[model samples]
Structure formats: structure tokens, C-alpha cells
Target chain A: MSAFSTGAVTLAPHRVAAMVLRYLYLLRSSWTRLLELIYWPAVQLLVWGFLQFYIAQNSGFFARASGVFIAAVLMWDVLFRGQLGFSISFLEEMWSRNLTNLMISPLRPIEFVCALMIMSLIRLAIGMVPVTFLAIAFFGFNVYGLGLALAAFFVNLILTSWAVGIVVSGVLLRNGMGAESLAWTLMFVLMPLACVYYPVSVLPDWLQVVAWALPPTYVFEGMRALIMEHVVRVDLMVEAFVLNALYFSAGVVAFLQLLKSARRVGSLLQTGE
Target chain B: MSQAAEPAIAVDQLVKVYKTTRAVDGISFALEPGSITGLLGGNGAGKTTTIAMIMGLVTPTAGTVKVLGAEMPRLRYHVLHKMNFESPYVDMPHRLTVRQNLKVFGRLYAVEDLDGRIAALAREFDLSEFLDRPTGKLSAGQKTRVALAKALINSPRVLLLDEPTASLDPDTADWVRAHLERFRKERGATVLLASHNMAEVERLCERVIIMKRGRIEDDDTPRRLLIRYGRETLEEVFLDVARGRGEAREAAQ
Candidate 1:
């Protein structure tokens, strides 16, 4: 069993890398792609950083925790960019009418998803790393102070975003280009429930229940605790990880199932059209 | 167990029904190994749908499609690497250069010594000069060559081509046809070509399967189809098939 499992594991990466390289080649060949990756996130940081500064100067509640808004915006972008990176890479295949070519290749749908996840990581890194440095240099607020907990929060948020991204990709596969807008707008639909800049307690009773259901709420609430109270909450981190595990599993299952239906309906070939 | 003599492609009672339309209905045929066969039909005649089913891109509503003796959409991955497809309707990523697009597909197909393979295809297709140009920037004929090169990257034994030389001038189209013939001869590849150009089909295919309204209206060699229709060319015979006269001619024969 061990030998068989190991052999199976060894065969998947090259295929996945091939899919990632498809996008990497695009990113390398197009200066515009590279520019777009870094441009918008930096602009978001600069704009939101000014807002945070203005709030810090004007509000006594914000004055005590000067970096909270900046940290929230940066973390929120981590989730946004992670999700957008994944979905948009899939969209690129559709836009180029290349999905049929990829689908017909030896690459399986699951492997395609794996490649999308890896591409998302690469894109998120390209998009977020420079902005993270800019936050420190421009706002004098370093998000890395969250230490090892920062990595935990980032993983949970990214995984949750991936869960959303997979579902959106599945929808696009089944519905065609008419559903392309979901790649950009789906994450925002969950923003209010995520409690990115505030505590869950700030929401109404019913709304708080909905907020608790989403894994990112715990990450942001934990971020708030760590940044404002200087308390390390392992319970919140554990809860976020568990919820993400459930959401990620469901997302993958849904995506794969939808892909099967798309194939049956001949929607996979029509995706690019 | 599959024997070596099993046909390269076998479709038995294949059917694909979309909501209100039966795109491909109960079609059955088999292509011998190393043979070049043509799938001919006018628009909406189910040629694309049948090819899509053969590639495992579209699942059949009923019946079976077995490529390289493996039942498809189920055992697709087992044989997919051994096959490749080309269609003017689909494209590679346009922003990437021709070389970049080829390299990516070569890797996806896990073609060994990919750089060598890309170099060979570029030379064979005369793509070296524009290899670094973005695919979208290339002229239509150049893009068609790149698409064909991408399809051949895996050295696929089974090739499915749709309108391979569509929208090209006669010289380029004839050049593309000659290259396909050479690829078949050199690789012993089994080709299922769908083309509207009856002349290209007559020149390249050993046998022809003409479809109409999701059914195989006629299946024979190009010469046999011409004789059966009492026509001078495959184009006239194709017109007879498209206008639903081929069925009557076949019944009369």
C-alpha cells in the first residue's frame, strides 16, 4: 500500500507544474500581467493607509491602536488577492479558449485545481509581498509582528479563499462566460459576514451566527485580539482551521461534481465561447 | 483485455442529447490504426459534438466511446497522453509567445526533451522566425500553424483535428495537409480529421464518415463516396450529403 501510494503521489506534480507553467509563461511574456499584479494591491494599500492615518488622527478609539485599520486592510487583501488569483487564472484559460485543450490533455480536473491553487500562491506572493513591505515603509506598521501566528492566519484565510474560489470556478465552468463577474464579486459578498475590520460582537445576534459560520471571521477576530489585546488565542485559530477544513473539502467536492455535470452537458467545450 | 489489433478508435452506439436537441444519435464506427479518416458534415451536423465525445470533452448521453481500447471519459487519462486534438474554434493562451505556448502544452503532455520537441515542430511548421511573437499578434495562418504545432507536441498516436486548415489560402492549406500526411506516415498516427474542405479530405483521408443531423449518413472511401453519388468530386458528394440526398443515394445503391 505504501509503495503504491508513493508511486501515485510522484506522478502528479509534473502535470500540475505544467499547468502552473502555462500561467507563469503568460506572466513572464506579458509586462502588463506583472504590472497588474503589483499595481492594484499597492494602490489599495496606499489609499487605505491614508484612510487609517486620517482615522488615527481624528478618533480617540482608533488613536490607541494606530495600526488596526492598516492591518485589517492588508489582511483583507490577503484573502481577496488569494481568491482572485485562483479564480482569475482559471478565467484566463477560459478567455483564451484553452480550457478544452487543457481538459483534453492528460491533466485531470483535480490536477487542474491543484495547479490553480499553486498559481494562486504565486500570484498572491507577487501581489502581496511588495504591498506588505510598503505597509511597513509607508505606514510604519509591520504586520509580521504577529509572528508565527501571522503564518497561521494567512493559511486559514488563503484556504478559505480557495474554498470560495473553487466554487466560483465550478460555477463558471457550468454556466460559461456569463458568470465571469463572480470571480471578482463573490468575495465581497462575504465581506460583511467576515467581520474583517471589527469584532463579531459588533454584528446583530442573527448576523453574528452567520459571521461565526465563516472561517475568516475567526481569523480576523483573532487578528484583532492579537493586535489590540496582545493575547494569543489558540482556540480561535483551531476553530478557523477546522472550519476551513470543512469548507475546503466541500468546495473541492462541489467543484469536481460541477465539472462532471459540465462535461455531461457539453458545457466544458462551450466555456470559452 | 485489449488486443494489439483493436482499432485505434471505436465508437459504438454513441449518443449525445442536449436539453431539446439530440446532437449525436446512436453513431458507431471504428478507425483502423495508422489510417487517416475524415469526419465530414456541415454546421450543426454533429461533427463537432461527435469529436468532442471522442476526446472525452463531452460525455455521451448513451453508448460507448473507446479510444485506444479504453472506455472514455472513464479511462480517459489512461490514453489521453497518447492523443491530441486541434480545432480552429479553440485557441492557446494568446498573450503567451508561440514558444511559450508550445512549451506549456509540451509540459502538460509531459513530452520528454520538450525543448527538442518544440525546436523540431517550430522548424517543421516554419514557426522559428515568429516563435517569440505573442500568439494573438500572429496572422491567422501563423496562429493555425502554432495551434497545429501545439497539437503535435506530445507526438500523439491518435490525432483529432477540426477544420485544421480553415481560413487559410490554398497554398498554406495544401502545405498544412502535406504536413499532416507526413506526420501520419512518420509516426504511424491514426487521424480523425473533420474538415469542410472536401478536397483536403480527398487528398488525406483513406476513408470518410459523413454525418447529418447527428447520424452517419454515409461511410466509405472518398472515391467510393464519389462513385456512389455519381459525382466528379467529393465536394459535390458533400453537397449531396448536406442536402440529405446522400441517404437516398445510399438506399438506391
Candidate 2:
């Protein structure tokens, strides 16, 4: 009999839930924490909502697709909150010096990743649901109007965020909290390249080549297609999914390898700001 | 093999090199079941690294670590639930109450009757008053008690402790030590304690392993260590090891 057979299922749901419960307890304890999750998304929505209103009245080009900016802002927060959600959960363990404790627990690394992913979804919902409603209320843009296509976009963008979040977490593991800024700043580097506010054709030929290589490029292109042309680009969504799969796998591998290196270098206990 | 015949913890030529420094250098030892071993060392002497390796928190560069018949970090999950560690340096989430913190840990350990366990630990640690208070609001002594409660949440068979009583007053420290002794007696748990308190080591540990510069300088009981080093106390013996007088004494002998 194998020694590990006793608990050798690939995933243990209770263990994953335990970690989720830990973060939930933390979230409920502080009202500021609960507010902070919703605060930034709401502020971003309002700022962009008024700006979109001004442009729609002034520019015929925007009047034809007035809801584009609101939709973009809402989806972008999905990506941001998803990534931040994951990184914050991991960082909370580090700041408290509890990573070592969790590492030594029976919870597997994969289970920990699952917990991060689940918490990411929870935090994303907490931050974005209100902002989406605000978008409809303030700018008359119903993000949900995209119907099933909205889900494809959300999934692709959030997958890409997890990929980036995992890689950022890896860098923090290898380099310590000095690299903590990467968690917040890294995803923005992809925003312009993602063509969030404009069509891919707006970019110069050389930059378009680089933009097409990203998963989000396909997502935004698909988003604009659904809004402006009233056409669903299943082909673009498929391409985004394929690209997200590759990046997310690479991210997971990089994280596990970095954690191994940390163990070899004895840095797990020393991880702190 | 029978449980008594097999070692609870077995380390063989374990080495961990962190860049240029060898944090743990080819150390080897074994602990019989239910034994308390004091792992004593000065600053940068590899005690913490060794404990981390045994807990499967650190990987060995060379050789192996076996806890309860499973290789460390590789097959750690097979036996992880059977082990737990406590350290003053590691903190539970501060915003979580003492009770909430206990609940989280109990859930992670998959403890059965978790509410009952928390209640028992709270009463045993005299934490009933502070159970609902934020853990960060507690005094240093109160926090240490809570940390101990968290460590024992799993009722682990192997316990690794690093400076388990660093910040408590003398009276509380004595009380904590007494409880630890009682815990080991009642559970028959194997404890590997890394502490700077020589008196605590002498009073509780059946065997002592003295390390210096990532090596085992001496391994014996406190009484034998005192006689061999011609010292009056384990603290003097520890100083001799830390100061490199151990080699001189061995050479003179």
C-alpha cells in the first residue's frame, strides 16, 4: 500500500475551503477591508462614466458606440480585481509570516492555488458587481447585455489575470516583498497592448504584431465586435481561450518551481517586507 | 516495522546550501518515538534551517529527511497532518479573533469536533476571556499561549518548536514549560525543541544536540555534556560550543 493513499486524491475540497474561510474571516473582521474592495472599482467607473458621457455627446464616432468605455472599464476591473484578489491572499500569508505554517500543513500547493482562484472569483464579484450596476445606472451601459458573450470575455480576461498573478507571486517568492509592487503594476503593462479602448487596427503594424500575441487583445477585439457591429466573434474568443491556457500553465509551472527554489534556498521563512 | 522500532524523525547527511553559505551541513541524527530532543545552537548555527527541513518547509540540497516513514517535501503530504510546528516569529492573522484563528487552523488540520477542541484548548490555556478578542490585541504572553493552542490543534505526533517561550515572563514561561511536559506525557508526542534557554533544555529535554556553524558540535545528555565540557551548566557548555572552545576541549582531551 502507498503511504500517501490515505489522503491521495488530487484535490481535497475541505482543505481548499479552509483557506477560503481563513480569508473570509479576515475580510468580515474589518469594515474598511470590505469597503476597500468595492471602493476603487466604483471610483474608476464614475470617472470613466462621465468622460464617456461627454465624448458621446461631442463625437459622432463615440455616439454610435457610447457604451464601449463603460464596458471596457467594467471588464478591466474584472481583470484587475481577479489578479489583485489572488496576490492579496498570498501576500496576506506572507505579511503575517503564516506561509511557513500553511506550507507545513496537510494542504497541498495545488489546493492552495485552488483556494486562491476561488477567492479571486469571490473578490472579483464583490468589486465588479456594484460597478457593473453603477455603469448601467450612470451611463446606461448594461455590461450584461452582451449575454453569453460577456461570460467568455470575463473568463478569458480572468484566466489571463491568474496567469499574470501567478507569475507575479512567483517573482515575489524568489525576490521577496521588495517585488511586491509587481502585483499591482504588472497587469497595467498589458492594458495598452491589450487595446482596451481602441481597435487593434488603430495600432501601427509593428505594435499590432505584439498586441496580437496577447490573450487580452483577442478579448477586447471580441468585445468591440459585439458592441459596435452587433456580431459575436466566436473565433476571437476561441483564440483567447487557447492563448490563456498556455500562459496559465506556464504561470503555474513557474510558481511551483520558484517555491521549490525558495525551499532549497531556505527563503520561505524569511519572506516578509 | 513496529512503531517503537522505527524512528519518529530520521535525518541522514542532510545538507542545505543557500548560495554561498551552508545553512545546514551534512547533519545526521534520529529520534526514537515520543522523545524530546533539544536542538541548541547560537545565531546562524543552522538550528532553524534543520527544523524547517524536518517540517518539510525547506528542501535538503543533499541526503534525506524522513518523518514518520515519508521523505520530506516529496512525500510530505502523506504525513503532514501528523506534524505541527510553533514559533514566536510566525503569527496568525492579527485581525482574526483568538477563537476564529483557532477555528481556521482546526479546519485546516481537519480536526474532528473542532468546536469542542477549541473550547478545550481555550480552557486549558486560560484563553476563555480573550477568545473573542482580536489576536493582535492580546499581550505577548497571551499570544504565545494562543500560538501553542494553534500548534496543538492537530494533535500532531511530531512537534517542532523554535524558541517557544521567547517573550513570556518567568512565571508564565515556567507554566508553559509545565504544560508542554504534560502534553508530551499525555500524548506520547515526539518534540524537537530549538531554544536558547539552557535551563529549559536541561529541565525538559532527555537528549540535547548542540550545533555550531551549521554542524553538530556535540550530541549527548545535558549531564554528559556538562561533564565532558567541564562546565557547571548547559549555558556554559552552549557558550563553549558557540565560541569554538568545543574543538579546543576535544583536542586537549
Candidate 3:
């Protein structure tokens, strides 16, 4: 029997909800926090929409595919929001010096991750939805025009971002709060390799090898395929899913391993400092 | 089979070595059910490390920690709901209200009738007025009360506390100690308290374990330790232990 099915061990929904409620209370209590959830994505959308329009008028490549850059920017926010939400939520516990309290509770590592995943989803929706509507109104581009493929691309990209978030959180755990910068920089390091605003072919042959290894590369490439050629690439979606599965597994393993290391070093209690 | 009735907490040869310095050298002790034991030590004496190990927050280098009869860092999940920890060094989310913090912890521990529990704790801790305020805005005494309320949210059988009354004024600190005494009497909880306040230990702890250089130097009741060191108070006994006079006394004995 699975751990969840057995009475011996199971992820308590109430405990997970408590974790989620903790973050919700923070968001609800602070107007700045609530504003922050939507501010950056809206600014990014407006700025990127103007850039896309400028490029579309001046650049021959973008002129032919007017919506590609706008679409890419909106889609990329999904990934960025996913990674930031997960890592920042974890950082909140450290900043508050509440990790020791949570660790000592009956909440399991997997359950904690699950809570962060839920929080990331809430953050992503709060951050991205308004911006997405702005993209349509301002750029004359609706990423939703990609239809059902947008959902597939979104799931793959967010899951891949979650994988990156897990690895960064592991770094924070194994090291200390000094490594917090990794939470913001780790995903952007993959941006060039992810080919977020460009196609994989634009990169040199050697770098293209690295790009192809990333799940987001397939996602953006698939986005370009749908936007530029109106072709749905099933193979790219499959490749992204397979790679996401592997990266997520490795990320979880790395996170759990680092948690054990942190415990051995007694860093869990001293994390905030 | 005969070891089935394990004490509330049992540490066997617990050791935590950090690179070169041994934070918690080989040590062993146990706390009987419903007893409040003080773990006393000076700076760098490993009281926090020992308490962390007992709470399964730190993995011992070469020993076992069994809490509530389950080997820790392994079966910690099985008994975690039955154990809770509190420390003034840690804080709850600053943006959360005191009541929200308590509610979060109460739900996490799956305490039944959580609203009732929070109301009761707020009344008991005199937290009703400030419970609606953000935790960061509360005074230190109020925050301490909230922390203690969070610790007891689970009504845990084993409670690990580190300087539970570190910075409070004399009257508030005394009140906190009295409440802890009431908690022990009412709940029959096993407490492993780590503190530098000798009077607090002397008053609340039935037995005291004095530690130095990551090892236990003496384990005795407050009265016995005072007699053994020819000291009038536990503070004097603590001073002698911290100054390494306990070793000299042992040699002379």
C-alpha cells in the first residue's frame, strides 16, 4: 500500500492548508504584498508589449510573426512566477525564523513541497492573469489563441520552473541565508538556455545542445511552432513532459538530501541568521 | 521487549561533531514521563545542540535519540505530533496576527476544536487584546506568550524548551514559570528545558543536568547539586560547574 493510502503515513490536508493559510495571511495583511503579486507582471507585460511592437515594425523576422514575442513574454512569466513563488515562500519561513517550528511539526518534506506548489499556483494566477489580459488589449495579441496547446506549454514550463525552485531551496538549506540570491538568479541563468524570446536554432551549435536539454526550450520552440506556422508539435510536448519528469525527480531528491544534510549540520534551527 | 516502557526521551551516546569542534560530544540521558528536567550549560556548552538533537532538528553524529519510544530522525514523523518545541530565539511570521499564528499552528497539529483551543490559550496567556495585532508589532512579552501558546497548540506529551523566558521582566518571567508549572501539573507533559537562568531551573526542574564542553559534568537534583558543591544556590553550583570546579570537586572526592 502507498504511504498515503496506509494509515501509517499520509499527508494531512489540514496541515497543508495551514501552511497555505500562513502565506495567505501574510498576503492578506499586507497591501504591499498584495500589490507586489500583480505589479511586476503588469509592468513586464506593458514594457514587453511595446518592445514587441517596436521589433515587429522594424525587424523583418518579428514582422512576419507579430505575436511571437508578446506570446513568449506572457508564457515566460508563468515560468518565472512559478519559480519565484515557490522559492520566495520558502524564504519567508526562514526570514521569520519559523523553519524550526515547521520542521519539528508532523508536516513531512513532501507535504511542505506540496504546500509551496499550491502557493506558487495561487501566486502565478494572481500575477499572470491580469497581465495576460493586458497583453491582449495592448499588443493585439492573445496568447490564449494558441488554444489548448497553451495549457500544455504552461504545465510543462511551470513544472520545470518548480524543479529549478526546488534545487535553489535545497541550496539555501544546505548553505545558509547567504545563498538566498540563488533563488532569484537560478531561473534567469536558464533563460538564455531556455531560448525564451528566441528559437533554439538562433544559438550556436554547441549551446544549442544545452538548449535542447532544457524543458523550456521545447516549450518555447513549440510556442513558436504554433504562433509562426500554426502547427501543433506533439513530439515537443512529449519531450518536455519526459524531461520535466526527470528534472522534477532529481530536484526532489536533491531537496530531500540537502534537508538531511542541514539536519546533520544543525542548520535547520539557525537558518534565518 | 522489556524496554517497551521507554522514558519520554532517551539519548544514548549522542554525539555531534562539527568539522573539528565537537558541538555535542558523546552524552546520554533520559527523562521519565511527566518530569521536567533542566539542561543547564554555559556558552558553547551544547545545550541548544542537545535540545535540537532531541527534537530531531539535528542529527547526532554517533548516537540514537528516542523520543516517546520512537528512534528520532527516523521515526520522528510518527511521534512529531506528540512532541513540540519552543525557543525565544525563533519567531513566527511577522506579518501574521497573533491569533492567525496560533490558528495556523493549531491546524498544523490537527488539534480538534481549534477555535476553542485558540480562545482558551488566548485567555490563559492574557493575549486577547493583542491577538488581533500583527506578531511583529507585539511587545516581547506578548510575543513570548504567543510562542508558548504555539508550542502548546498540539498539547504535546514531550515539550522541548530553550530559554522559554529569556528576556522577560522578573514578574512576567515568574508568571511564565508558574504557567509552565501549571501546564506540567495539568497535562503531565515531559519537559526538557535548556536555560541559563539558574533560578528558573531550580524552581521548575526536579532534576538538573549540568553540561560543559559538550558533555554532562553533573546530573542531580537542585538540592543535591548545591550540597555536593557546598553552594547555597544553583547559581553558585552552576558557576562552579561552568568554571570547571566540578571536575576538581570530583577529583577531591
Task: Give DockQ for candidates 1 onward, in order.
Answer: 0.68, 0.68, 0.72
lDDT of 3 by residue, B33-101 (tens): 999999999999999999888888888899999998889888898899999988999999998999899
TM-score of chain A of each: 0.95, 0.95, 0.95
For candidate 3, the docking band is: medium
User: In model 2 chain A, where is the ten-residue run with the lowest total lDDT?
Assistant: A1-10
Off by over 4 Å in 2: A1-9, B1-3
Choose 1 or 3, whichever is better by TM-score. Answer: 3
Mind giving the per-residue lDDT tens digits that candidate 1 earns over B56-160?
988999999999988988889889999999988899888888988888788778788988999999999999999998899999899899999999999899999
lDDT of each: 0.90, 0.90, 0.90
| CA displacement after TM-score superposition, residue B239 of candidate 3 (Å) | 1.1
Off by over 4 Å in 1: A1-11, B249-253
Candidate maximizing DockQ: 3
The predicted structure with the larger TM-score, 1 or 2, is 2
Interface C-alpha RMSD after superposing true interface residues, each candidate, one decimal: 2.8, 2.7, 2.5
Residue pairs that clash (backbone atoms under 3 angstroms), model 3: none
Question: Which of 2 and 3 is the better model by lDDT?
Answer: 2
Residue-level error in angstroms, candidate 2, position B84: 0.5
Models ranked on TM-score: 3, 2, 1
